[model samples]
Target: MQLQELTGYGAAIVAGLVIGLAGGGGSILTVPIFVYLFRIEPVMATTYSLFVVGTTSLVGSVSHILRREVDFRSTATFAVPSFVSVFIARWFLVPAIPDPLLELDGFVLAKQDAILYFFAFVMLFAARGMIRSSEPKADKSAPAEPPRYGLLALDGLAVGLLTGTSGAGGGFLIVPMLVLLAKLPMHRAVATSMLIIAVNSFVGFLGDLHRNDLNWRFLLEFTLFSTGGILIGIYLAQFVAPMPLKRGFGWFVLVVAGYIIVQEILTSRSML
Candidate 1:
């Protein structure tokens, strides 16, 4: 591969490792890598990231299933509503939100900026989740019975809407919810989160397919590298404890969130 291609592949591997090791920050980094490194347009990069993350998550889910870590019943409960939410958000809601028109002192708020802002906000939220994850949980028992179908459906719908709108896998949000609200163990939560992400990402990707603007070459390379990284990450997970990973992930998300906020501020000022 050429130098740039090698670098891109390396970046993808890093992204996958982060996701496999932790769960959220890795996918978030994909956008910045595409925009800054690969020089892809932000809008297109988001779509591409969706495909890469979705596919990678699917691979991870398979691994989890092989290990018998996945909760299929819970996954189904979450995936179903999430799928519906994705369809509604991608097809209806996003189209309805008018792009910002007037610039504040020439700070033009492009549609892309709006998307980035949303992404940054989500990153902040994810960071908060990572911080909270470091705290000891009082309850560690899986639900005696499967979660009430209605609650799972609601969670899935909310997760799906966010995934469709932001092109995220929703693991950051889902993992915590599964642990805190659904009373699942952390490892099971991670496995179940992967399944939910895989499903939602694929469904959301379908929506993007209608636009027909994906960069297939980049997507394929990203998936290949990320898959390799995930394999390495999984192996590493066997030896390392999760606490270090959680703290490292939290810090990384904080840095990314800061960078995104700065970029938005600069974009706004440039418009002025």
Candidate 2:
């Protein structure tokens, strides 16, 4: 109804399109949208982000499933541990953190601001990976045998911690692990990452249900737009070039990350 709400919804749509087309950057932007555009507190923004990213990725994963690109065995190995890690992080670690997270002689850092700063740090890493990421060479030799279960589980744990802390799906992190560690073909890796994100995110969201009072109506509306955007992005992929889009979007992410760092610093100083 109002302009601000519309912008938030529009941001959700754009986020979904990015995920659908780029397969990794969508969830990366959700918190920034919620924090800056929707003016949500960082902790709650992360909670909302999990829902948005999870549902959007779920829709995207369905197409991969239909195309026979999902690897269920591998998905199970990776996702199970990730789910545990995220649940613990959400249900325990996040809530256990004290507000005014850090205090020094003359400085006091709020928990929400600390979380935003950490999210920005993760954003920089994701952007760098995206900009420097080379498309994987086509798998031409033989069928991809599933990689070591131990290694996949280890990666899952690490990524789950990263996702729960940052409220990001960590697809940028997941895709490479799937290919390099799990030995999945690139297509299957992308698809599997989506499912893993969906599970980690929504399950993490459940931990937030009792932690905060959420506006479900708003979340559902945002998610609906994101789903629509994913469909449009899938259709547009037929004509659009992914490389140029990804590289350009990577630069945009970098700029946004810079802004967050600077913004947090200023907010810290202003509070003094």
Candidate 3:
């Protein structure tokens, strides 16, 4: 393999490792890796991201399920509308966007540029949450209150749309909602978010199936490295403190988001 391709695969492992350790941010890294390193188109990169994040998260969810940490009732409420909305977005909304998304004055925003910009902004939001990290305190002794299904479904739809458009797993969004809205404990909330992400992302990938000619060989190969990374990360999590790692990663993501915005603007200017 070429050096760049080798490096890209290495980065895949790192992305998965981050997810394994942190339980989030896989799409933030995976989409960028595909777009910049693998030289995939931005739209297609999102499609690929759904698969990578979905499959890896599925594996993680299975483990959580085995441990009985996953809350199926909340998962259903949050994930059903989420997966449905994501499918609609991938199948109809994404394809419907015009190539040049907007034009005003002398500046033109192409579809690719728009997607990257949105993704970067989402990354910024995710980074802020990470940088100002505080674990949500849940009282394990308190009697379990029922989840607010109405709010969860609404939140699910919104997150689903975002995931479909950006190919994010939406764990950053989902975990908080689960903890606060569903009244799940922190650990259970994280586990439930994994299941929700796995379902939402896979269905989103299905929505893209009809539009894209996928290179299954490369996709599976890339995912293998990511899966391996997740295993390594899970092992390391036992020894490592996650908060410090999350803070450092938040800074890294902040830089990457900045780079993407600047690079896209520079590329657009060159094209203009």
Candidate 4:
């Protein structure tokens, strides 16, 4: 095939490896691949990202499920509000946002730009958490109590808003919420977030279906490549190291966030 398409597939594989290895970071790479590599528009790139992220996550989650790493009760509790919020965000909140969302003297904020800025901000926030921790540590000194359903529901709602608006799985948000609110161990938290992301992303994709014309040919191919990468990652898991990998991934995320923000600002300036 053409070079761009080949690179797109390669990108999907790398993204999937991230997901498979880390259990969540893969989706963060999807939008950038679509936007910069494939030259898809930001709005549509997010839509496609939901499909790629959701499906690849489903595959990854299945491996975790077979290994019994997934916590079903906690996943269900966190998913309730998250599911609802993501659907609403995609179906209503996103579309209702008018283009040129803001206008001021000599400056204007387009809807696409706003969405991207929100995405970049989320990435930076997530990167900060990862960088600060260096590694996910659960306090095993004390037994984890039963999940506080109320806090889980609230956290899910907020995470759903982030996922729906940005077409991100928001694993960075979900994993921590699972640990803190659901009292899950770090490993279980990551595994459970995969299932939640699969659900939330597909629901968000459904919302996009009503508003956008999908390029199914591209989506399927990209997802398939990503799925293959997940398989490779699963095989490579025995050799993977978490701490250094997480640190490196966090730095990569920070750089990407900076790039997106700078690109948007420069583009907007030119428009003005």
CA lDDT, every prediction?
0.76, 0.86, 0.87, 0.84
Ranking of models by lDDT: 3, 2, 4, 1
Query: What is candidate 1's CA lDDT for residue 143?
Result: 40
- Please tell me which predicted candidate would have the highest lDDT against the true structure: 3
Clashing pairs in 4: none
TM-score of each: 0.89, 0.93, 0.94, 0.93
lDDT score at residue 221, model 4, on the 0-100 scale: 89
Return the candidate ranking by TM-score, descending: 3, 2, 4, 1
Of the candidates numbered 1 and 4, which has the greater TM-score value? 4
- List model 3 lDDT by residue over 133-250, tens digit each: 7677756798877778899999999999999999988887787788889988767887788788889989999987786589899999998998888778767867977668878888
Candidate with best TM-score: 3
Candidate 4 local lDDT, 1-272, one digit each (tens): 87986888898998888777766777888888898889898889999999999999998889889999999988888888898999999888988999999988868898888888988888898788767654546567978677787988888899888888887888877877777778777777878888999998998898888765788998998999999997787677669875466668888999999999999988987877
Comparing 3 and 4 on TM-score, the stronger one: 3
Q: Please, what are the lDDT tens digits per residue for candidate 1 over residues 157-186?
A: 888888888777778778777765666777
Clashing pairs in 1: 82-156, 106-271, 106-272, 107-272
Distance from true location, Cα of 245 in model 2, Å: 2.5
Cα lDDT of candidate 2 equals 0.86
**Alpha-carbon shift of residue 189 in model 1 (angstroms):** 1.4
Of the two candidates 1 and 2, the one with more favorable TM-score, higher being better, is 2
Which pairs in model 3 have colliding backbones?
none
How many pairs in model 3 have backbone atoms within 3 A of each other, for residues 3 or more apart or on separate chains, i.e. clashes? 0
Q: What residue runs in model 4 are displaced by over 4 Å at the alpha carbon? A: 134-144
lDDT of 2 at 134: 70
Global lDDT of model 1: 0.76
Q: Model 4, poorest ten-residue lDDT window?
A: 130-139
